[model samples]
Target: MGYFRCMLRNRVSLYLVLAGGSRGNGDGDEATTPALALGGEGGIVADLISCLEAVLEEKSGELAFPGLRQVFMLNNKDAIVRRAVRSDLAMFLLSGWARAREERMDRYIKSYLDVSWTPVMSRLAAVAAKPATVTVLRRRRDPLATFNSVLENACSAQRCWKVPRPVLRHVLRRTVSEHVMPAYRRCVEEVEQPAAVRTER
Candidate 1:
């Protein structure tokens, strides 16, 4: 998990490098967030894929669902954690898109993109919660199934929706459950998934 997390950050850095090229710095100026800017050509996406290639070259381990992950983001996650999380998250996002395209689910599609509460996330949530009529016609998606269909992958189109800034700031926390965030809070501070200390049982 830690390595994957670092790789994500490093991948972003590598993307930055590619986007800007090796440039000279001013004596005391700060580097601006080039990736944060939207509506550009989205070159970081290419850099991100390049970073994933670099990471795979460095780390050699087998995973159950590399193919499915290529469809999502690269594997910046534990299989267990990711599979669990995906059960809910990916189903909603992907299925919604499919329904919108096929059955002309225009309203849900708009809500999915133009959400006000949590912005895009809320939109995705709404799309996920749509009645079966929306999804029953499209296709059967297990949502948790590991996909091995090797198609070309890119972070554009379906994967490139940006969260509106105001709504994003208001609901920036990843999960609503407070206990979900810091499992590392320690030593008399409570933690939900703390490492078990050995005791003479």
Candidate 2:
């Protein structure tokens, strides 16, 4: 138990150190502090995960966890001091939001999620879920396009043709579409940028 605890603590400290952002001063001190304080490794991990997830769900105007999920799993995501490299520097910059739509989202969706979608999320995630998916998010080439597609599907299946899926989906579609989409869209609009930049048109 002691060994596990030490190992965990070290792991947590490592995340903070890496994701902690900023390089040390000439004196070798950190330039910034991690967002959450952890007493134990587990706590650090949990809190950081929760904070990251919370940010995703709310669609706050900041990137939190994105293309870096893989990097995070590999324990390689670190906050950048600046946008020296677009992808790495802005991996956590919040993409499109989903909480600004017009429909009344199913609040029970989350409760249902704890038991239902979690498994499918990981299994068929590439085809069925979206980011902020508690289980597995369906993978798509373009996240924003994925967002639009999911919205269209939700409206169709739900037969409302209005509300977004995943209550946050609705919210983000609304606000994010209005606010962030223009810029983010332009970023993704560059088809030559990457394969995922297929076409939101």
Candidate 3:
């Protein structure tokens, strides 16, 4: 319909405006044309990213629709703008837009994801399904000291024996949530018990 066509055109204009990075002059005239502004490629690229993110957030539904999708795709390709001039700007913008779209889908739509983590999930499930036993040793006189000793020993064993150095390093450094540290702490709760207790004199 005419309405849809108009909507698509407006979306296309928004993309171009963002890509172009036009600003108004104090005299109320459109100053610094796209070509002129694009001379400073960094600013143009940053503006393009900001604009595309805003547009993607605003037009979440229409972007996924057929006609609008085609329009966005073709325009983003920028066949009209030669590779000599646009260089990789079109490609950069398109990739940013795609990421923005995926993030939007993940945030707004339930069970919708653009990435496949099936292998990771399967590995996690396999590890979790394995049977294991845990034992709390009353080695120290104080219960708290015993618990602390068990926790320390468990964490060291998990870090050094069970997990690879590189994976452990990355997980420890990058994992910011409260659960990550507590999950590491929970290692004490899952250790397999030994048949005999050994203590040094």
Per lDDT, the best of the predicted structures is 3
> Which scores greater on lDDT, model 1 or model 2?
2
Q: Where does candidate 2 have its weakest 10-residue lDDT segment?
A: 75-84
lDDT of 3 by residue, 1-201 (tens): 232234344655644765456565556868433433553443444454445545644664465422233223323323222331344344323334444544443343122111112222333333223323122333423223433554455345334222223543344334323423454344423333242431220
Off by over 4 Å in 1: 1-13, 19-27, 34-43, 46-201
Worst 10 residues of 1 by lDDT: 143-152
**TM-scores for all predictions:** 0.17, 0.18, 0.20
The lDDT, on a scale of 0 to 1, for candidate 3 is: 0.37
Tens digits of per-residue lDDT for model 1 on 1-201?
A: 444345445655644554364233556644344442322233343334335545653552342322222212222212323432343222112223333222322332233223222332332333334333233423565321211111112112334433334433233223222322232122113212222321121
**lDDT, candidate 2, 1-201, per-residue tens:** 232244344655665565545455558876443322333332343334335544544442242422222222211111211111232222222232122111112332233233322332333333233323322212434444554554455335434222222544454345434543454444333422433333332
The lDDT for every candidate, in the order shown, is 0.32, 0.35, 0.37
Q: State candidate 1's TM-score.
A: 0.17
Candidate 2 ranges with C-alpha deviation above 4 Å: 1-37, 60-201
Q: Which structure is stronger by TM-score: 1 or 2? A: 2
